[model samples]
Target chain A: MAAPVRNHVWVGTETGILKGINLVKKQAANYTDVSSVTRDQEVNAMCWGDPQESEILMGCKDGTVKVYSAEKSKFTEFHDCRGGEGVFRGLGVVDNAIITCVESGLLKVWQEGASDSLELQVGAGVQKMRHCDAHRQKVGTGGKENDLKIWDLQKPEEPIFRAKNLRNDWLDLRVPVWIRDLDFIPDSDKIVTCTSYHQIRVYDPSSPQRRPVLEAMYGEDPLTALSITPDGRSVVVGNSHGNIAVIDLRKGSVLCTLKGCAGSPRSIQCHKSMPLVASCGLDRFLRVHHLNDKELLHKVYLKSRLNSLLLTSRDKWEEEERVAPVDQDVKDEEDEVWDGMETVEEKTATKRQAVTREPDADGVVKVPSSKKQKKKKKVA
Target chain B: MPHIIYSAWGSTCPAARPPGSVNNSCKYSDAPAEGHGAPGPSLEQDVLLPPTFSVSEIKNKQRHHYMFLKLKQDRRREKLALKKKRKKERVALGDKAPPKPVPKTIENQREHDETTETDEFAPYFNKQTTPKILITTSDRPRGRTVKFTEQLSSIIPNSQVYYRRGLALKKIIPQCIARDFTDLIVLNEDRKVPNGLILSHLPDGPTAHFKMSNVRLRKEMKRKGKDPTEHQPEVILNNFTTRLGHSIGRMFASLVPHEPQFTGRQVATFHNQWDYIFFRFHRYLFKSEKRVGIQELGPRFTLKLRSLQKGTFDSKYGEYEWVHKRHEMDTSRRKFHL
Candidate 1:
């Protein structure tokens, strides 16, 4: 197995295979034993276990959370949380405790070496649950007919904020509520969400109004996944038709649409600081696109339908290039030879500078000599 | 000045030859080369002819028709002479002639798809399970669709046809799973014509939706064979090279019984060309050591895949493995998905 530091993206597939992709090397490797895996163990959600990203916690379809250690390149632990009725929708970690939410809306917090776990029922038909990066204890839950609700882990009895449904439409019929995915905007109290009805909405919990402050529509198909940009001014949303568009959060307008995806995207995640976004889905290909130019940078066929993806927060890609090559001493020796040759060029350059300065000094002396001769002629 | 006149004359030579002689354009092109090689009488003729001359520019229709007929007759004579020369050359080198070159086709020059490994059909290929298929149609299917399903059920072994009765597929899936059916097929109709097909593998699925067209019933065929037997038929899958193509081929393979009964001498073929799946059924007979014959068992149709979903029959919420986006995917004529 290659070093986990070299892999920039980790994808969970429907065939119960975990794939690690290195964009710089243009190689993808399956991290799981394909022969031993069954369809019942399909990976549904994944998240970094720690701030250093050395551990990954994957939630599977059979109500098991498996922890993969990047340093060891293998799975180190598995915890069976089987009270939920459906597959897990989200996974998170806070202070060495694991947070898991399932489709049937069973949210649980399991502490290390503890027999009893803190469980909460957010609602039924939960589509997604996302942890807020700005606050450790904050998490949001939403789904079909289930409005957005932010829960504080410390106070599990009541939600901190509950989003109200939109007003009746022009036909006087009730508007439907189906939140497919959501992410909390860093440095603010705003939570942005994409709905199954192709609507992107941002709600301000700090404001008195419980309704969404902004709403925008992209395409006609249902929006399946979304991720906030690093700057948090825009959000990237992918629909069921394999169309991904970056929409502005402030003015509620589309910025640009990313192309080259053939099937519906299951998961999309933007890089922490780079102008790049990685998405994988039913097409079985992991594609990385530049958010600024929307150019497809890398595409890797992982040979299975991808369910979720996790992009490494590491920003130093060139550092991995220097560490990847095994022949370090050979490179150092080559550098020494080049360094020795550079001094010879420096010596010739100094000699040429000295020769050029002597001519400038002679020209200065000749001008004064000519002036003196002209002065002598005027005196005569 | 001569170069300019030469180019103008070269452009006008083909149009000046005749109408309905497009295939003889190669022979006419050689005329300019012969003129350049032997420039005695041909040069004088070229100088006399107008540069912008064309048969369409003729003012009189009768004279134009007469010239066209004469040119056609002359080209036919030249073609016959060339064929005679080629036949004589072949006869001279009868035993030592080089093999004829093979023709190129879109299938032979197809772009390589990277995903061709076989993985998903292990259970079916391992002979662990027998095929039990349930064929149904869209709610309230009309004349042609009813007949088509009846013929399809007769062709496939251990299959039964049921009326939809307007039940939701999501509801029907659970009942079908409890009954231990291996596959579920639903035929869709539009304006009393069977136009769509949805094939979903049972228990765990990778459902495929196809656009169905050109359905011909047994009675409609000109000289079809008699009604098929109850015995299992041999299956033939052709040109399924790509990864998606392999998946589709496996799906079709699982539709029939694993063990073929050769005593029946019946075959069902699914041939893929230009991404369209052509299905044919036939009955074969061995006449002698070197002689064989085949009769068509009718109810043949063509299918083009529209979308393949990961799970069973949940179009609204299920994820698609591949979807045919006409404007985006069909940009190239040579590129094929299946």
Candidate 2:
């Protein structure tokens, strides 16, 4: 298996910059998009291109799918998947095909060696297309005023599951539909969705009830992003107001709020094994929050407004600490050498002034013995 | 004789003087050749002495004074009788003291008192009508600071962001207020990390300064593996850690958007160095048992602050509007800014 990817949060920014943030090291490494020499393209969406999670499939605003290789530390391939109407909303890699979904709801599957891509219509106004790694063949699609539908890639005909709107409100008013973000619960047929109306709803397709099995509300601002906690019993959701809260699915109540995020949070992802959730947003900040106690672990400023981020499982900084002793000694020696150079410059300047002053003394300056004797007599 | 006496009294009373005689005399005087002798009193004399009475020259002064006293006594008696009658009527009606003239200020004070009394009991009632806020961090904030700023913004209703690195709190306060921002939060950073925060409420302000330490995020905490289904119990926030903290918390709580949009599923969260104040709200839900239940969800966290200061922000002493006051009070009068 490809060496387990190092533990880092990969972030895509609006300015087409990709950043790998080392949480343990508390540092961010930036990579510029070299595809266009003229102007930078907006990185709209990104997904792991291969099962090894070494290649990042980047969906650009300009209808291009560029695969950035983490091993090579550069973009390896570029494919043009022309969006007919709106910009790309989602991007993913299913086996050898690059799956891309645009805002206009055109889902295209591009084969690795093929010039032309296979197309499928996912209805109109698709906001997000989510691929479930647990069930590799399933992808979820939803948007504003659109029903949340899950589709099987193997059979592109009908949706495996589609969420039904809850019964009419008390006054018989039709509830408006606005699905912001959703995630499929691992090992279950349940899907948890956070809405723009500040709601968290969990729908179980296995059950006969069309309405959500559990629904809870978080903050006063519409929830823009959400991620299932490592335990899968809770979900961490962020709103347009930049508030992040962990809501318990069973009780439908907020467990705690993880504070210290400003600006609207765009995306949130919880690590599968660690009690950590990484979030990024318009504030251009990548924040890692501990799940159980709601404490912020590490914060990296990426400089540009971050739209989405992915976190790896392994910790790279932990390995660096094991090999830091020799590197520290070398760095210390270099530091001393740099310090010695500053002292050398000062010593040379003093000598040059002494040499100039000696010329003014003329013939008397040639008698160094008499000059030193005179100076000693004056001191006495 | 009665009619003659009445006419004599009318002529003597200057206020009751007939207009015809004055006009006739004026007309005759204008034709001086024909009417040099046609006046009872010359117009010139009338002009000089004006026929108006001085207080001392009035013949009915004593009588007028006596009549005034009599009328005053009668009015007093009538008023007393009316008051007694009203009192009797009120007693018959089983009413309390008569209504007094309540000034607008007193009315406002009483109205405020009633609302506050209600708020003391049911703080969750109608919480949506709070002011919208705008939260920003001090210039060149680190990632953690921006995240904190966003967290603050999310906890308040209708709040938006104005992100300019290293923005002066004084400059942004007025601009945010002009934009209808009810509150302005400025996260102050030291050595590129947030260590202080200033919550300046817009328009009228009691800008709160809090020294932040042990700055921790959720990720920094060790997992306790607490019961997932234990539903974090409801906290009774009737009393706060400090009086000032209570007011600040109330002030922050009062900024939630009124008439919450159920479809949008909004939430408000407030967190400082110590405590986390959360306002989780779901719109109307209809069920059989409760019929209609509105869930106001949030869990409280501890918050700590150095001091609670009021008034506008200023560069000197790092406070505004209170510059003159601070200068008068401070003996050293040194300039300080954050």
Candidate 3:
């Protein structure tokens, strides 16, 4: 029986191209646009519509949301998000609604009919919006001059948590506010945000202070994207200089850096069960690395700069292991002594040539010794 | 009168009776003047007269409200009289012209369907001459602009260069049009750096404007030794700022022939043209770090379509013609002001 195929890592490119890589086979498939018009070709954001990740929700620069189904290998539906300004900065799926956010901080939750039932203004110039399935109803938003805000879509009249700006420095100067990417700590009220100032801050809503409880600085370059590891104790972050590293959540220390990336990373995602991390960026390469020792597992050159990616839950290595066939007609003959083979014609012919290594000085028929063979070769 | 005055002062005022009334004795105990060390020797029978201003006439002091009301009523009456006079005049004049009864249609009278209207310069299409482009920049062109124009002329076959110093666009455009120039490419400067570009086709036009940023030259490119002019360089237009911009950029890039060929003894090589056409097309997240870094979407190649036009673009021209075809493909022509 053939091995069951695992999940495919999907990447959305700036050219509105969708590329899927099957890690087991190390194969890539490209999906082109159905129309010749290039307006809707720049894919700005992407999200999985279903829990099993069979449906992909792609947001284009033209404010159109395209639903592509992996099962059918074609786009299932296209819905225009009318009045949505600027490129889509975030795309998410919550229950029966398709949630989208633009750079102008217009967040809309669309039902099946594409009518926005719940809409919100997260303030203008929003850079990133993050929604975790674990906390299905809540989302986090932040950007320039816009502090981190956590809102419950079900009750969005007021944010559930609003972060305050950190206190002025010792010299009494205002601190800059630019939150690039954020993630909700699984099963907890804690949130981690990586900023353009190269700072990773952890905010606990349950705490007394409204500011981040733990603050630590990473590299000098601004961080662009981050994803929480499976265990939820560490976060893997990627910066504008194509530097990706893991940080310990408890101590906020740099754990290890993953190498071989050159341009700014656009997205970083870690699988829920596997020790694999998938990242893609302006370098136009999709890279998967093992979290254990940071060994680069697979690298695929996508034709365009990638904006976002989705790592499905299925493990290809496990399926490959299970389907690896076994050979049975083998014999262990390396150390076998064949005494009956000496009388065989073919065996004696080969043995006589091998045994006639050097003629002795006395012309006596004796087995060739190491010293005598060396001495005979020297004399010749 | 004094008793009436005391009663009118109300019970809350201990001074209502001038400290002579026994009924107010308890309220006067806290008075510091008569208590402790101060001596109060003089006691005179003082008579309080009526106040100079009448207390019951505050309502009479508010005269401005009624005056304003009267003024408003007078203005309304005057306006009504003027309107009646105007109406009478209009009725008398109605028989003469009737004001070209407003052209009733779906569109406003001022806005002709500009995209669908046929341009006046269609006769130039039959000439079959290669496009002659005039490349120039704003007054006092920067060093970068001059260098870019030199590089640009070498890419596009018969393009010429000029500086708009001490000359207006109105003067230059007409002169170029009269001189048989097919198109004009203008680089606008901000702080002595080229930041915006305008490409207008000759005579009549569907001009395109683009925001140019992150200008990198061949010397700035990472890979060296490969002459930028050697190969027919592939153009990459990365991350256009708008959807319409993306569509227009793609339309422009598609004009270049896929394979270069020599029609006679001449072969035109498009070299550093891609660099000028492919400006950094990205939205900066923070204004402070503007143009420092980019979230490059992907490589996108763009060309100035107007600068390549042989004849004026008419939306009502041939169906297969790019002018009308692109106008149809891009539904948001209103945004790009096409």
Best by TM-score: 1
Per-model TM values vs. the true structure:
0.72, 0.46, 0.49
Q: Second chain of candidate 1: TM-score?
A: 0.65
**Ten contiguous residues with the weakest lDDT in model 1 chain B:** B1-10
lDDT of 2 by residue, B1-338 (tens): 33333233333343333345443234323344333355576766555432333233435767546544544665587678778998887787775657746767754575323213222213334443346677777767778767656544544445676777666777777777677766676767788566776666666665656655455443343432221121212222333454334556665555554454444433334443223332232223467775874443322223344334344454222211111123322345342211
Can you give the DockQ of every candidate in the order shown? 0.17, 0.01, 0.01
Instruction: List runs of model 2 lying over 4 Å from the truth.
Output: A1-7, A33-40, A315-317, A320-380, B1-338
TM-score of 2: 0.46
- Residue-wise lDDT of candidate 3 within A19-97, one digit each (tens)? 7877654668776542343535678888898876678888888888888887667787898875557888888998768
Q: Write the per-residue lDDT of candidate 1 for residues B1-338, one digit (tens) a residue.
A: 43333334344665444344334334445555666677475555576444455445656788667656655776798788778988888889998877766889997688754333435556787677788999999999999999999999999999999999999999999999899888999999999999999999987898999999999999999888899999899999999988799899999999999999999999999999999999999999999999999999988999999998877888886767788988877999999998
Residues B122-222 of candidate 3: C-alpha lDDT, one tens digit per residue: 33332343467888888888777677666656555567888777787767877888998867778777886667676666666535555666655444544
| Candidate whose lDDT is highest | 1
> Order the candidates by lDDT, highest first — what do you get?
1, 3, 2
Model 3 steric clash pairs: B236-B300, B236-B301, B237-B300, B237-B301, B238-B300, B239-B281
Label model 1 with its docking quality class: incorrect
